[model samples]
Target: MSSEEEGCFVNILSRNISNIVDALLHGPENAFDEARKEGLLEREDLDRITNKESNGDKIRACLDIIEGKGNEKRICEKCGQEAAKRCVTCGILCCDQHLKRHQQEGHNLMDPGVKIEKLRCTVHGDLFKFYCMDDWSLICPKCKDGQHKEHEVVPMGTAPNKLKVVLAEKHCRVLKSIESNESQLHEVQEEEGQTQNAGRGAEDLLEKRRKELCQIVNETVDLMKGQINKRKMEKLSLLGKQKEKLEQQNESLHQEKSSLQTALQEELDTASFLQGSKDLLKRLETMSDFKSVERTPLPVLDFSKEEKNLDGLITLNKNFLEKIEKGPVEHPEKVELDQNNLRRLYGRSPSLDPNSAHRQIKISGDLRTATLTRTGNQYPEHPDRFDVHPQVVSCDCFSSGRHYWEVDVRSSRWWKIGICLNSMGRKGGKSGLGANPESWCLSKLNNEFSAYHNKQRTSLSVPGDHERFGFFLDCEAGELTCFGDSRVLHVFRGNFMDPVKPAIGVWDYYCDSVHFVHLVKQTFITN
Candidate 1:
C-alpha cells in the first residue's frame, strides 16, 4: 500500500473503532453526536456513516483491521486484489479467492493463546530434544548417546512434570521438618518460662524464710533484754532499801555527836555543869554504844544465764541459715508421716550375716548388731569374710521396690554403712565397700563424713555425731539415699545390676561398734 493511502486507512479504521467503543460506553445516539462535535467525521460524513448501509461497512472494516487486514490499498499476496483476510500463521495478507488454497497448502491457523518459540541447544546446535535425569541437563539426540547414554532420559515436556512431583515431595518434607522444629522450639520456650517462674517462686520462698528467721532472732534478743532489765530493776530496788537504812544510821550518829558538843560548850555553875556533863556523858555513852550495821553488798546482775540462752538461740539461727544457704533439701516424695510411722510401713530388719562377717566382727546373739571385736574369731575360712578390713553384710537382700533400714554407729569412730550388690567382690584386696565398683557407701572417719564409690571420696557436709543413720532405697528407680539424724545427707543414683544387701563395716584398727535396729512385725495401734 502507498504510505499516504495506508495512513488515511489507519486513521479511518481507528476512528471507526473509537466510535464503536464510544457507542458501547455511551449510547449510540450520544456517540453519534460526540463524533460530529469532535470532528472525527464531518456532519455530512457522520450522517452517511451512521446510515444502515455504511454503518455495517465501517464496522466490518474495523474488524478486518483488527485481524491485520483490509487496508484501503492493500493487495493480496496470492492475488493482486484488495485483501479481505490475513494468513495469521504466514504473516501475509490474503483475499477470499486463495484462502482455500492457502489452507490446503498445509499452513496451520494461528491460535492467539498458544505461543511457540524456537529454543536452540548451545552445545549441539540442535533443539533441546531430551532431558538427562542424572545430570539434570538438556541434551540433543547426538549428545544423548555420547555423554548421557547411561543417564535416564525423558522427553522435554515429561521431564518437567516428573521434576514437579519430586520438587513437591522435597518441599513437603522441608515444611514437615520446619513444623517439627517449630514444635520443639515452642516446647523449649514453654519449659524455659516454667523454669524461670519456678526459680522466681523459690527465691520468694527463701526470702520469706529469711525474714521470718530474722524476726525470730530479733524477738529472742528483745526477750533477753527484757529479762535482764527486769532482774536489774529488782536488784536495784533491794539495794536502794539497804542504802536508805545505812544513811539513817549515819545521820543519827552525827546528831548525837552534835548534841554532846553543844552541852560541853555551854557556860554553867559547877553543879549545873556536872548535871549537864552527866547528861552529856549519858548521851555520849548511849550514842557511842552503836552496833555496826551488817554490810550488805549490792546484788550483782549476772548475764551468764542470758548469755548461754543467747548462745543457744544463735546456734539455732546459724543452723537454719546454713540450711537456707544450701538450697532446698530433697525429700522422698511420699505421704507425710512421722518417722516411726514411716519405719513401720517401709522398714525391714536386716541382720548381720554370719557368713559375711569379718573375723574381727562379732555378731550379736540376736543377729541384730555387729560390733568391732578386739580379737579375731576362729571363724571358718569363707570367701565372703573380710580378710583385711572389718566388714559385714546383712542377711536380707533386696532387688526391687522401696526398702528402709536403720543403723546405729554411735560408738564407731570410723565406720562405713551402705548397700552393696550381692555379687560384690568378697576376697579381692579391692573388695572393701566403696573401694570397688560394686558398692556405694557412706563413711565417717573421726569427725569427717564422706561418700565413697569406685575409689572416689566425696566429702559430705554432714555431722559426724549423728548416732542413727537411716537408709532408703528405691530399687526400681535405682536410687539410694542416706539420712543422718533424719536429715537427707546424700542421694546416689545408678543402674543397679544386682540385688543389693545392707552392709555395715568398721575399721579393724579402731574397735568401734555399730548396732542395727531390727524391725519387728507388730500392729501400730493409733490412738
Candidate 2:
C-alpha cells in the first residue's frame, strides 16, 4: 500500500481505540470485569484494555465530566476562551465567538449520545429503560433477555406514577385510622365526666342519709334513758311500802315488852303473881312475834346491758350508712367500674328494716347494717322479723323486671344474705332465710361458704379477699346470678315467687356484721 494510505488507516485505528477507551472509562468500574466473568470477553484482553490501576486519572476525569465539573475549565479549541456549548457531531465545544460560525457550517449542537450514555446499565453497558416488577428493580434490554426474561417488567418512566398512587392510598387509610382513634378518645373523656358528676351527687346523698340515721339513733338513746328512769321510780316506791310495814310491827312489839317489865316490878302473893304470870304468858303466846327490822336492797341499774344496746344501735346506723353509700350493682361488663356505675344502671337502693331485725340482731339507725349481739336488742315485734334466727329483711321488694344489689360482707364471718319471698316464715321454726322452701341465700360459716335453697346447701369456692357480693336477679326470667370481684360465682334458675325481698342473717357470734350496699339511680345517664 502507498505511504499516504497507510498513514490514513493508522489515524482511523487510533481514533476508534481512543473512543473505546473513553467509553470504558466513563462506564461503571466493574463493567469490563463483569463481561469477562460472563465469558463475553477474555480476562487478559479486558485487563489489557481497562488497565484499572493505571487508569485512575482517566476515571477521575470521566467522573468530573459526568458531574459537570469538567465544564468549568472547558475552552474552545479555536478561540482559546470559555466554551459556551458542546457539539454532538464532532464531540467538541465552542465559545460564543465561534458558536455561530460552527452552527452556520451545519454542525449539530445537541449531544444525544451523552443522554443515551446516562441511561446505560452498569452491568451490561446497554440502555436501561425497563423496570422489573418481580425483582422491584431497573433493567436493560439485555438483562430482560437474560436473568429477567420471565419477570414482570414495565417502562421505567411510568413506575414513579404507579408508586405515587399507592403512597396516596396508604396516606388516606392512615388518616382514617387517626380520626377513628380520636373519636374513641373523645367518647372515653365524656364518659369520664359523667362518672365524676354521678360520684359527686352520690356522695351528697350518702352524707344526708348518714346524718338522718345519726339523729334517729340519738332520739332512741334519749327514749331508752327515760324508760330506765321510770322503771327505777316504780321499784323505789315498792321498797318504801315494805319499810312502812316493818316500822309498825316494831312499835307493837316494844309496847308489849314494856307491859311485861312493869308487871315483874310489882311484888305480889305467889297465887296472884302466878295468875298474872299465866295471863302474861298467854298474852305473850297470842301476841305477834318481835323481830329486828330487815333492810331492803335498793334497785340497781344494769349499765352493762344498757351500754350494749346503745352500741348495737350505733352499729346499726353505721351499717345503714354503708348501704346507702354502696349505691347499686353495676353490670358485669364493667368489672373495674366504680360504685357510681351501679347507681346509674340500677334504680333501687335497699336498706335493712329496723322493725324486721331479730332481737339478737342489732340494727343500726340507718337500717342498712346489722350485727349479732351477746344480748338481744329489744326491737319492735314485726311480722318480717325472725324470732327464731337472728335475721332481718330489707324494706324494698322486687316483684318483676331486673334487679341488682351488692352486700359488703367484710364484717361478717358467719352470715347469710339472699332473696326471700314475702310469705317466708319470720316468727320461728325452720322458716328463716335459706332454711325453708321460700328463701335462698349465699351463706358463710367461718371461712367456708355455700349456697342454700329449700333447706339444701351447695358448696362454693370463696376467694379469701372478697369483701363484696353482687346479686343480679331477673325476676321475669326466673334467673339469678351472683358475682364476687366481677367473677360469676353462681347462676340459679328457679320459678321464684313474686314480691321477693333481700334478707340477711347472722349467727350469735361476736363482731359478725353486714352492710347492704346503697345505690341511687340518678348517676347512670350515659346512653
Q: Which one wins on lDDT? A: 1
Question: What's each prediction's TM-score?
Answer: 0.36, 0.35
Candidate 2: residue 216 Cα off by (Å): 42
**Candidate 1 residues 125-159, lDDT tens each?**
55455666666566677888888888898765455
Tell me the tens digit of each residue's lDDT in model 2 across 1-527: 33333223222322344554566667634544553454434455444445555565555433333323232355454555666655533445567887887567645453212332444577997656566655556677899989999987765545444433433443344344335434444443444344334323333333444455576565444444444444444434544454454445445444555555455456642223333444454554444333234333322333343443333554545444344345322223323333344444553568888878888888877888888888877766667667888888997776544667889988877888888887677886786677777888998886888898888989899778689888877765686777778777777777653568888888757768998877654422111
Clashing pairs in 1: none
Q: Please identify model 1 stretches exceeding 4 Å from their true place.
A: 1-338, 508-510, 521-527
- Indicate the worst ten consecutive residues by lDDT in candidate 1: 110-119
lDDT of each: 0.59, 0.58
Error of 1 at 271 (Å): 99
Error of 2 at 473 (Å): 1.3
